[model samples]
Target: MADKLKFALALALVAAGVVGFYLLGEQPLVLRVLAVFAGVGAGVGVAALSAPGRRFIDFAREAVVETKKVVWPSRKETVQTTGIVFAFVVVLAIFLWLTDKSLEWVLYDLILGWK
Candidate 1:
């Protein structure tokens, strides 16, 4: 299929860029950036040519549209949730640190008999 060929060509381009990055050691920064871009373009082009890629693109577009229709949380709700998360994180961190210290003390002092 034509799609297969395009995919193969894109893969080839990406492979060439990877190889070039290692081989073309003294190339200018601009050239290197261009090579990387070319590789990415080739991959996207190949994916575009494939049926699955088209399906994925369509699904992604629909998801974005749906996301736009969402009613996001208000500022107050966002702040409260963020504060709660921060407090939980701080508490969890202290708990973990205490646990780690207790384990270390037990292992080094009691089990191994090391001061």
Candidate 2:
């Protein structure tokens, strides 16, 4: 029950922020943006007080920890892999171009006798 109320309040805060942005359209762009950010920040703060928000925070922390455990490739390995990819792409492009030109020649010059 308490969690639901907190979530509702957070949603209201966010909605109010959006409404304020449109209502303050005649104001300076900087001020309008600031108002919107302030509302969003407040909404997030209120949401963080809720049970679901706490679970989300826990999930985010776990994700960061798991990310840190990943084995990233070295700069040299990355560069070599990228170069290999580029070479393969170039070869494939040349092969396709030759295939297309060959088909065009056979269809137009040899088969159709158009030109």
| TM-score of each prediction | 0.66, 0.83
lDDT for each residue of candidate 2 in 1-115, tens digit (9 for 90 to 100): 9999999998898888889999999999988888889889999999999999999999999999999999999999999999999999999999999999999999999999978
Per-residue lDDT tens digits for candidate 1, residues 1-115, read 8777777877888887777666666988778777777787778878776887788899999999999999999999999999999999999999999999999999999999999
Best candidate per lDDT, number? 2
TM-score of 2: 0.83
Residues forming the 10-long window of minimal summed lDDT in candidate 1: 16-25
Q: How much is the lDDT of residue 113 in candidate 2?
A: 92
Number of colliding residue pairs in each model: 0, 0
RMSD of 2: 1.9
Model 1 clashing residue pairs (backbone): none
